[model samples]
Target: MTTEEKVARRKLSLLELAKDLQNVSKACKVMGYSRQQFYEIRRNYQTFGSEGLVDKLPGPRGPHPNRVSEEIETAILEHSLAFPTHGPVRVAQELALRGIQVSSTGVRGVWGRHDLLTRHERLLRLERAMREQKIELTEEQVRHLERFSPEFRERHIEVHHTGELVAVDTFFVGTLKGVGKVYLQSVIDCFSRYAWGRLYTSKLPITAVHVLNNDVLPFFEAHNAKVSTVLSDNGREFCGRKDQHPYELFLQLEEIEHRTTKVRRPQSNGFVERLHRTLLDEHFRIQGRTKWYEALEEMQQDLNDYLVTYNTKRPHQGRNMKGSTPYAVFKKGLPKATKKEPRKTAENTA
Candidate 1:
């Protein structure tokens, strides 16, 4: 960039930093600029755009009045472009060999005005000059260059209808009043927010498969719906590389696709996560501690009553299904996935 371009970039950067920090004093302190200068640059940029940053040299419009001749200045720029690896000192020495007699400081000043001081900056200019050429990049290089991006924002998925996707996950509900520590395996519809879960004493793969088979599948059958995909995290129960996982085998036999969230990416399974939080606040935290329930069967009965209230009576606050219950929204959904006749899933005691 030219000196004018550098000044404009500095001014623009300061303004952006100030807006982001939301404090002019702190922006100035970090950017190493005085408040007065910041205000001047901001005012000019607002009034006249980036062109205002150019130094309004008050003298002649042509080259330096008495300094290096036009011929010598042209020689300096040509030599610098021809040999970008050389710096100001080397350029001056090259000019001396030709009897041009220009100091290193003079050559540096010329280079600064033209913005050709750094080899990286010059190479960028050369690349711009060759913009019409086709450039192919390797896959690894493309992946490695992604660090230059600002940040990764979550992409929102559009919900066409209920049963298009189901997200399942296991949440660790605190120990019941009389029962030991337990878990709840929940499967929730992404569209209607309809949910179903079962209390389990163990967090095994079989527990997850039973939740899907007994609760989730029956619910889908009642509405004549098919789950296009079941999303989950990479827990041992819902995910594995081999076919030994009972949950994976169950999904396969049921003709439903199983998808796991990327490693370290829990947001991909956010629907089930939100459902877990809601249940924690409304169901488990409120009723489980009111009276000690020694038997897991008693807790299961209490959970079923709450699930009815949640699906049929509670008014959901979702934007898509306003003033409607989960059961109401679910009744209106149509199945999208292909349904196949049920078959027994393979069982192996490894």
Candidate 2:
């Protein structure tokens, strides 16, 4: 028998001996227990019978305290379903705001029991599927891909004019409204991290080119920035030739030099891709809206506010030693010839 069971049997024997001997001290000596302990066991056996000797009775009891109640668990399930991308930590904070005292670990345990850990896993599966569909390259083909990658170039350490190098990419927002998907076409100035984005219904090359022409180019022109080289991934939308493909006409019109990253290597365009993830985590997922496209106007407005804050107000790590925004960095690097003087100065002098 286990030690606990053996101890329980001995305690029962001691209780019987105490009753039979009619002397607590005599029973205590025989049982190797103190007089106080003998009397306690005798009281327990008298009050609760044989079961009392198996385990000590729970200490003086009142009503049982409730932990996370059923109502709170239901709320957690609802919140998680509505916002699948949010982790337990965020959910715990949200629950706290609703006056529920729950831990992130508690929420995670609940999620684990309910089979709700699918967001990241789904992304990994999708990435794996994409990789499987991709053709394996020979050493020569791999070398060719590397030659075309922007990472092949040594990043210029010197301060350069704005728009000398632009990073461009398309990233999908999480599945929206449980039906259609939304794509974000984004471009960031390599020097400033000043970014612009457009929401598209599709990730088609035609749609991408349209956003670049209509929205991105105008923003750059308005800021007096000109993109000399555009860096992007080898995704079919970005790298496919026009004559061989459906988007050939649109591609020819943009006329900018296009460079692709090594296939499946997102780190080559790490800055813009990192921004994509940050946008989803910090803004999209936290906002807790189920149907994102239905709130497209609001989403776009919030994104613009975020972009303006990122460019003009937020401190950028990519900014040089000056410790300024991307906008500030780009302004600081303006060519002296391009800098404009105040007009009407002589006329106003009189």
- Name the candidate that leads on TM-score: 1
Candidate 2's residue-wise lDDT over 295-339, tens digit each? 556667877877787779877665362668877876765444455
Q: In model 1, what is the error at residue 185, expressed in angstroms?
A: 0.5
The residue ranges of model 1 lying beyond 4 angstroms of the native Cα positions read: 1-152, 336-350
lDDT of 1 by residue, 68-132 (tens): 77798899887876777788889899989998889888887777787877888767667675686
Error of 1 at 33 (Å): 44
Q: Candidate 2 clashing pairs?
A: 242-248
Q: Score candidate 2 by lDDT.
A: 0.71
RMSD of 2: 23.9
Q: After superposition, how far is residue 306 of candidate 1 from its true place, in Å?
A: 0.9
